[model samples]
Target: MLHLRAVCPPEQTDQAIELLRAHAGTAHLIVHRGAAVAPEGDLIEVDLAREAADEVVDSLCALRLDRTGGITLEALDTALSDAADAAEEAAPGEGADAVVWQELLGRTGEESRWNATFQAFLVIACLLAAVGVITDSPVTVVGAMVVGPEFGPLAALAVGAVLRRWDLLRQAAAALAVGFPVAMVFTGAIVLLGDAVGVFDTAAIVGNHEVDFVYQVGEASFVVALLAGAAGMLAMTSAKSAALVGVFISVTTVPAAGYAMVAAVAGSWDRAGYSILQLFVNLVGIVLAAAIVLILRRRKQRSGDLLRPLSRG
Candidate 1:
């Protein structure tokens, strides 16, 4: 659910209220006129269900309240009121299983954009992975995985597949297809240069025992990917973003990519291929898991709405 607090001039209050009313799917109306301490205008509070949040926000944006006059909008977090509880109880099964794919797509698109922050994260993750492989430290490898930002694109791709949004799928695929290879090449070059300078050696790459752990593919890897993907999607949508850090640390894609680069530099083509395969396995598992979850959520939403008609009568 979403709660909004708006301080708008007398002239804009009516329009703002209208916008909220029109877009909010199950809004429990609350009007407190002329009870604001802002000394500028009335304080209008709006409470909306979670499913209706996106539409209500869109309507609010359309009003241009931010630009027009001295209007301020603030989001509030609060428990549902009795009225809201009653409304939910009355509606029962209505919209219970709605997928809200467009909302999820919008979120994916926003997070998966190829931006400077993402590039920096990618570089850092790859660097960490290379360093980890050279040092033969599982801790460092996990750190590198945690630092990687590749999951956003992967999640976006899964969402695209579920929604059948070709544009989103294309953008996500390009990012993943282009981004990982680029990171690998750059890291591989670094490894090569380091090797030439005697800063890294074949023994450090091949003798370092961490390669065995990353190259082996099994049900554990698939399960980890599946759990990470679900947690990632939840983190993206949920207010608790801090949990995503944990999700990032749990995946092996970055570590495997880094290991692959190290193996290539050390002239261990077999190990390099194995590492690459491991990375692919994890990536595919994550995308498939996320897509399935999204599809299920959508189906549940549809079933809920079908059972209960919009009109109470």
Candidate 2:
């Protein structure tokens, strides 16, 4: 469920109220007229089911409430009231299964921001992977995967493709295009520095066998990437965030980039080529799989069965 607060103009208040009151999925509707000072409008608040939030928000926007007034939506983590139960029951589908499209757009937009924190995490993660691959340590490789922030832009890429948001596509693409190379270069320089200090050597790349999977790309890599992408996108869309950790650990994206950079630093072109190929294959598989998942989910949301009102039919 979601809590929606709207500051609506006097003229549009009645229409907005009517829209919410008419919807079976809305409950706990309250109106305090002329209560807002900033926008100078009446304050209206309502509880909306996850399955019905998109429809209600769309209708509210159609009334120009978002332009002249304001709308704030927040998820109800603990809705103990019976009204919340009634709202969910009246909605078209289970809350967990609902795909709130605007919410996803907002979330992806936030995650795709290429700020300093993003760069820091990516570089640190790649550096960890480089060490893990050099030392042939599976535990370190897993740690690198856990620490990597690469999934956000990848998920945003899939979202942009599905929504046809060219700006989002470009932003996400830029993040990936610039982020990977930046991380790799930084990791390579660090590896070279370590070699000069005798902390790492060429034998690390040539003799390692335990973490060799980091550089090996094959049918399994694509299949694993496809599965992870599908699961990750689904988790994001449905707000089941706990499932994303599994997706993060399952994909070999960070490990491949880390290994490739380290191998290149050690003058192992063959290994670098294989690792780069692994990275490319994983990326393509994930984007393709995630886009397909979003496309199918949007289709399901548009279907009459899910959109039909529960109260009427």
Each candidate structure's TM-score, on Cα atoms with residue i matched to residue i, is 0.75, 0.95
| Candidate lDDT (C-alpha), each | 0.71, 0.89
Q: For model 2, what is the error of residue 236's alpha carbon versus the real structure, in angstroms, after optimal superposition? A: 0.5
Clashing residue pairs in candidate 2 are: none
lDDT of 2 by residue, 1-313 (tens): 8999999999989988888998889989999999999989999999999888888888899998889999988998888889888888888877888888878888888888788888899999999999998888989999999999888889899999889998898888898888889999999999999988999874667874889999888999999999999999999989697999999899889999999988888889999999999999989998899999999988888894554774423
Task: Write the residue-wise lDDT of candidate 1 on 278-312 in tens digits.
Answer: 89989988888888777776676566656643433
Leading candidate by lDDT: 2
> What TM-score does structure 2 among the candidates reach?
0.95
Candidate 1 backbone clash number: 3
Scanning candidate 1 in windows of ten residues, the lowest lDDT window is: 67-76
The runs of at least 3 residues in candidate 1 whose Cα sits more than 4 Å from the true structure, single-residue gaps closed, are 3-45, 52-75, 79-100, 208-211, 237-243, 308-313
